[model samples]
Structures are given as structure tokens and as C-alpha cells.
Target: MNTSHQTATVSSKDGATPPAPRTRRRRNVAVVAALTGILGAMGTLVYFAVPLYQLFCQVTGFGGTTQVAAKAPGAVPGRVVTVRFDTNVARDMPWQFSPPAPVEVRLGEERLVAFAAQNTGNEPMLGTATFNVTPFKVARYFNKIECFCFTEQLLMPGERKEFPVTFFVDPAIADDPNAGDVTAITLSYTFYNKGAAALDEYLNRSRATAGRAVPREMNQ
Candidate 1:
């Protein structure tokens, strides 16, 4: 009887120990799964953070990003400020670019500025422009109504085209203490070739159109 009791007790203890390891394994698996889910979520957020931040800057004019407006500021101020224009082109882009000399205008007064571009390349090309305003702090107050930077430009070889930018400084800028010392603002632009894909698409369309058209001799 004593031997039987001892065997029974040992059997009970062995059975209890087996369940404990299984429970521990289950807990460990749950922890690993939870950690993996958290890391994946973080990676997704990081991927989307950049474009979201840029949109926020463009909308709020934070970080010296300028604003786009449909119309000029309604009120004009007596204060006069000088606006200087700057232009640049990428080394790979075969184009001559020029900006007009500086001009002075009253705050909230609309001014139209022109930039000239000529294609020096032997082939027709498409280009796009990017622009920004400086004294970075003044970007929020510098408003552009219309600008060529809004569109892509196509120029044939030896072709020259003039682009215009209409803009004004918000009269409310004077209310900001940080802008008190600001006297001059510079608008700068740089042009780059659009891309091979755009050029190829244009060429393909031209070829397709030519194929469908009847030659003048055939029509006659």
C-alpha cells in the first residue's frame, strides 16, 4: 500500500509539471506576436510621416513654405519693399534662363514679374520649374496668385518663351514683430528636364497622330 501511494503522488506531480511548461510556451508566443505587431505599426507610420509633414507645411506656410492664393491681398499698405528675382537651371538642362531686375512695390500691391527661357538643345524638350521665396521667415506673408511654376513648359529647339509670376506681399505682415526688420524678399527658381517618360509619351502621341493623317498628295 505504501509503494502504491508513493507512485500515485509522483504521477500527480509529473502531470502538473507538464502543463506549466505548455502554459509558459503559450505566454512567450503571445509576447512575440504582440512585439511584432507593434514594430510593424511603427514602420508604417514612419513611411507616411514625410509626405504628411510636407503637406502640413505647404498648407500652413510653416517652415518658410510660401502660400498660393487666388487673388491679391485686399488692402494696400504705404510701406515699400523691394523684390529681387533669381533664376537657375540644372547643368544637364540645355536652356538659357534669365529673370528681370529687381523691382519695388508697396505691400499688398500686385506685381507681375517675367522670366525668359530659351532652349539651347538641338532637340525639343520639356521642363518644369520649382520656386521659393526667401528671408525664409517672410514666406508665409509672400503670396503668389499665378506662376509658371504651376505648369510644365515645352519648347522646341531655338525657341524662346517668357513666363510670368503674379504675386504680392500681404499687408498684414507688418503686424508681425518678426517681420519688422525685413526689407527685401527674393524669389528664386530652378528648372529641370521633365523626364524621359514625358518625352517618350509626347513622341508616341505625335507618331500615332501622323500615322492616322492622310498625306496632302494622297488627299489631292
Candidate 2:
């Protein structure tokens, strides 16, 4: 009887259960939570990053804006008129502008205008420009087919470059009562320097050394 009792006590002690199953469940839950959090963060980043970057580029002129360069096909031909080109850079930007010699073109024929931009300051300046027809109404008939302002320009100090724009007035304008009477159109350019964040410190230092005031138009 004593031996049987001792045997029974030893059996009970050896039967102590381990917590292996519970531990495994807790570890699995933790891993799943971690994965969920990481995926959520990645998704959130993707959602906001692209659009924010695009908006920043547009406002800062890091990426050039879309502009129409050519007139619509099949426009009516009208009397030739002389057009003028004007360019304005920010005051802080050290640059020079030269207007193209005026030329006469018929209403439907394409005309090309040229301008010379020179970096007068000591530092390299990088900027983008956009062109528009003044008086807004004339824009309907004035068409530009090729323009350098469509892209960003990197000008080294003392560098001079001639940019050309080819454009024409839509012949159709001659038929429209609102546009038919218009004889002259003005093409204007507004330029801005890329923000410091988009430009490197070396370039920024160059711009500062140049010590030019920001241009009035770029203040907008």
C-alpha cells in the first residue's frame, strides 16, 4: 500500500501542464498587430505624398506649367499686325531681358519672336517662366506653338541665352465679332526662382551673393 501511494504522488507531480499553447496565441496576435500598423502607415503616406508634391511643384514653378503654343488649325487669315514681347524677372533674380525686334504677321500665319536673357549677377540662377496674352480677351485668338518658357532654365552667372517663341493669331478670330476688331496683342512673361528647398545650398548661396531684390510680379 505504501509503494502504491508513492507511485501515485510521483505520477501527479510529473503531470504538471505547460503553457505552450497560450504563449503561442499571444505571440501571433502581437505580430498581426505590428503588421497592421506598418501597413496602415505605408498606405497613409502614399495617399498624401503624390498630390502634395504636385501642388508644391506647381506653386513654386519647380515643374513648368502647361501652355498653349500654337493657334488652332483652320483659322481665318486676317490683316498682319505687329505684336510685342515683354519679360519680367523677380527683383531678387539677377537677370537681364531683351525684347525681340518687332515683326509683322498676317492673322493666320505663324510668327516667331526672340528674346535674350542674360544672368547679370555673379551667381548661377535657376528659374522657370510662364507666358500669357495680356487683356485676357486677346488670348482667345493669340496662339503660341512653340515657347521656351514651357520648361525651366538654368543660367550660370554671366550667361546669355536667346529664347524664341513661335506663335500666331487664329484666323477664326477675324470672323468672331468680339475678336475681329483686335489689331495688336502683347505677350508677357513672369519668372520665378525655384524655392530654396528645391535648390541646393550652393545655388542659394550664389543667389544671396548676387543680392538682387525679388521682382514685383513674383511677389504674388
Candidate 3:
């Protein structure tokens, strides 16, 4: 009887030990599976992050996109006239701006107006611009055929660069009776730093505060 009891206890202990190994094996497998899943997710995210960001940029115009400004309610196209270009920097910004002495063209003709942008600031400035027409209402009639504002300008201290823009007024505006008598159109430009990180932060902050996404292609 003593032998039989001892034999039964040993058998129970042995059975318990086997189960422990199986449990350990299952735990190990689970750990490996979890780790694999995490790594795969990370790899997928890394692969798609850049392209997703670019798509976001294209859709939001975060960089810049062509846009038409506000137009006069009753504006009609008039005789094709040359629209002039000019630029100005804030007092703190040591920059120089010069547009063509006399930018001229017929109403429907596209002309490239050139400007000399000089960085007079002591520090290097990354320049990006947002432009709008002086008379907001004429934007519908005034069209930019080519513009440098679509790209960023990296200016070193004391750097001078020539920026040009090709634009025209819609001749159809002259014929539109609703368009009020429009004489001169002025295109205005505002410059900002083109640093992507800074721009992203600024935009994000603006969106948070305003509760609206800032137009990415606003100035361009």
C-alpha cells in the first residue's frame, strides 16, 4: 500500500511538470507573435508616412496652389491693360523690393513682370510668399499665368534675386457689363519663412486656435 501511494504521488507530480513546459511554450509563442505584430505595424507606418505626407500636402495646398482671389460682383472685362507688380517687406525685415519701372501689356496679353528681391537682413531669411490683388474684386478678372510665388526663395544675407511673374487680365471681364469700371490692378505679396517644421507648427497652432485648417496653398 505504501509503495502504491508513493507511486501515485510521483505520477501526479510528473503530470504537473509536463503541463508547466507546455504552458511556457505557449507563452513564448504568444510573446513572439505579439512582437512580430508590433514590428509589422511599425514597418508599414514607416513605409507610408512620407507618401501620406506628400498626399496631404497636395490636397491641402500646404505648400502652395494656384488660386483666384475675390472678384468684383459686377466687374466686366475692360480694354486689356497692363497690370504692374510690386513688393514690400516689413520694417523688421531688411529686404529690398523692385518691380519693373513700367510693366505694360494689352488687356488680354500675358506679360512677365520682373522684380529684384534683395535680402538686406543681417541674418539669412527663407522667403515664401502669399500674393493677392489690391482690389480684391478684380482677382476674378486678373489671372496669374506664371508666378514665382509657387516656389520658395532661400536668400542668404545680402543676396539679391530677380523674381518674375507672368499674368494677364481676362478679356471677358471687359465685356461683362456687371464688372464696375476697373482701372488699375495691384498684386501684393507677403513673405514668410519657408522652413517646413516652423511652418507646420505655425499652421497647426493656427488651426487649433481658429478651429479651422488654414489653407495650405493660401499665398502660393
TM-score list, all predictions: 0.62, 0.56, 0.51
All candidates: CA RMSD (Å)? 10.0, 13.7, 15.1
Per-model lDDT: 0.88, 0.76, 0.70
Mind giving the per-residue lDDT tens digits that candidate 2 earns over 124-186? 777778788966777867777887774667788899998888888777666778765667778
Output the better candidate (2/3) by TM-score: 2
Instruction: Identify the candidate with maximal lDDT.
Output: 1
> 136 in model 1: Cα distance from truth in Å?
0.6
Stretches of model 1 off by over 4 angstroms after superposition: 1-67, 203-220
lDDT of 3: 0.70
The top-ranked prediction according to TM-score is 1
Displacement of the residue 124 alpha carbon in candidate 1, Å: 0.7
